[model samples]
Target: MKVAGRCGEGSEGMVRVARGPRSAAMPHLVRGMHRVLLALTACGVVAFAGPARADELTGTLKKIHDDGVVVLGVREASIPFSYFDGKRTVGYSQAIAMQIVDEIRKTLGMTQLRVHEITVTSSNRTPMLLNNQIDLECGSTTHTVERENVAAFSDSFFQYAVRMITRKNSGITDFRDLAGKPVVTTAGTSDERLLRSLNTEKQLNMRIMSARDHQEAFSAMKDGRAVAFVMDEPIVYGFKATDPHPDDFIVTGTPLGYEVYACMFRKGDESFRALVNRVIVRSQTSGDAERLYRQWFTQPIPPRGINVNFPLSEQNRALFAHPNDHALD
Candidate 1:
């Protein structure tokens, strides 16, 4: 039986089915097989039948066409990374997502692809990818060794160091310096994983609080419910800029670690992955990538409660300097 679901932007559309029939007369066994095939297709496991045609698209490309659009998962709350500019969306992540759509169109010999917006929080983004609910995620997601088990990452889109935000008097100087202090982070982010690992490996007594999203985590710290907020360096800077009492808080902590952010897909989609990589590469070479960054991160993100000046840290500069290659390590 045919099925339709609301993908990005709360829009109704049909998703790709590998073998489902348009009629309900199809047997349950066949439908089961169809689901399996769809899963395979979503992951790019099986190549489409017949000769590979430049005009014929499969996996994400086929889904994009069937839906008559591209569904991009993004966090409207994430500034610099992914967020809206009034009615229109703008950010480093959205810009890269658009580039990926262009590459998919070129690969399929199509002139256009529709863009659909999907709202996702930290907890559900990765799961959404595995279930085929999100064609591509434009939110800031870190690449980690353990996460690679289930998700395929595009070329490194951004990079930042993991740092801590605490009340100015809390006195946390560095990561290794936070021995027994409690730390807070959004649930399902690589920051949570990194903090936990450091706690164990360093043999330090650390209590960690998990928030459903970054906004929540920041609120906890602002309200003095938590001692510190741990996250990527850019996020910390953004928060500092918007805090009502910026001087009341201080962001300190040795670099616990570094992370590379990338767009995500279901694992095993080599063809789709390659297409995404090419798009970022093309954007970088064309100079559009730099322009997008300047437009988003450099601009004031008032309601987002954060603002970072143009040009990111020198440490994470390579993501902007070069493009198109995976930055997992």
Candidate 2:
């Protein structure tokens, strides 16, 4: 008698085995056993009959199930995207992350799920996610193809242009004017990458300085250590609105580039990524995301009563209309 066994890719592939003739009841027993084993494998309880591979069924969802906690990686001062509000973390991304947590709880059939918050800067956020130090990164992280190679990103929640913030009287109105000037950007950020590319391509001779985070970069600009601070336009607007002398600074120049902001997680986890995408899509289609956008962009936020007053751009509207995880060019 011969029986076919189904398997998945890799070691989990299906196989067929033949056995000598046996009692009529043997067929039923073999079939029953096969069904049970298949069920176990489907549940991620059993792998191929050998040493289990280390890469099997490990990701954000599995970790949440095992630990009963989901850690959120938040930024200290990415402004209305993610930021510290007094001792509490609050912002657009933070709010969206909480919604995801709620969905996770319901999906897992847990009455309560403990959430742990970890503050992450641009320099550490990616490594932290890769190391499983944080289950979800709810910050103003750009979704670039290079980054997507290492991490998974949800559909873009926000789109921003790369621009520079300089003193109004600095005579740096465009990217061309930045030649030979010292500019600061957050270390380990897309801003740094764009600036470097611009410097090399345009032969701008810009003196580039790296700050550990956005606040430090802004301070460098404030203290004259850097003639300009280059970052995402929304972030620049956030800092400018909160600055003591808002009129003293200006965000100028043609946009260097546009960035799509999305929540990040470790790669190779389709289930977890699908869950995150579902939540994001629902928010966009249900008007929930738009409400949050207005809450953060139009209304005043914490640390100070300041509003970025940024309306949703048409590009973002198109993104929400057809949510996708593809990196924008």
Candidate 3:
């Protein structure tokens, strides 16, 4: 069945072995025809939108619905996607996750459904879900075949190019410039793996320092321990913005690879997966997705009230025009 906007294929992409895991500033035409190309893309998941049946609840939905609570996996500083704004979980992805939670509440007919949060990192997000510690991981998680081999991912929301950032005087404008220099990326991430492959494939032999998180990766670059910090473009831009001297850093390099970001959960549970996808499609079609993007990416955001100042790219505009579940690997 053609269910929603530009739909993606089934989990036919990379999944990182252990694996894991848009906004709206939208346009007027996108606003009007947002629900145009959605189709049933994933192999078996359906987009059924009927009312939730308590007696028939299953999987994650059943556990949360029966328990009257939903657990969220949040990030410490993934910037516009999922991050702590000092006090609360706030970001574009976090907003989308909350929308999903609201749908859960409505579907289960539990208005006062209690919601809780757990901090998850690149290393622990999957284990937390597989271990049933958190119901949904809402952050900048990429959907890949290896990861999908173990856990499950929702439909794609953001697509980005993996790149690196460095000081203006670092003389590293591209991947070729970092031969044997120390470069940092968050551990347990696709970016780290990609960098590793590039180091060997291109014979760069650069020292790869895998930090525990983006903050630490940025710190390595900032303190001159690492000449460059490799990460997704949007994330590195956010990191660049966080710098006291944003002008000192520039996000540059040829796009080594492309990937899609999606919400993650345990494998199986097609019903709950369908619910999550439906919420994302609705956001895309109803313009909630675009609004969220504008709010987080284009406008000023929390913590330091800094504006990422990143505009919606045309490629991303297409994703919003037609949402998909496909992964880039």
Task: Give TM-scores for every candidate, taking all chains together and pairing residue i with residue i.
Answer: 0.75, 0.82, 0.85
Evaluate all candidate structures by whole-model CA lDDT and list the values in order: 0.72, 0.83, 0.85
Question: Residue by residue across 80-178, what tens digits does model 2's lDDT show?
Answer: 889997879999999999989987886576658899999999999999888888999978999999997888898888888999999999988999998
lDDT of 1 by residue, 157-192 (tens): 777788888888876677766677667898998888
Candidate 2 pairs with clashing backbones: 7-14, 8-12
Give the range of the ten consecutive residues with the poorest summed lDDT in model 2. Answer: 9-18
lDDT of 3 by residue, 78-146 (tens): 998988887898999999999899888877878999999999999998998999999999799999888
Candidate 3: minimum summed lDDT over ten consecutive residues — where? 11-20
Candidate numbers sorted by lDDT from highest down:
3, 2, 1
**Top model number, lDDT:** 3
What candidate 3 gets wrong by more than 4 Å, as runs, is: 1-51
lDDT of 1 at 162: 84
- The 10-residue segment of model 1 with minimum total lDDT is 6-15
Q: Give me candidate 2's TM-score against the actual structure.
A: 0.82
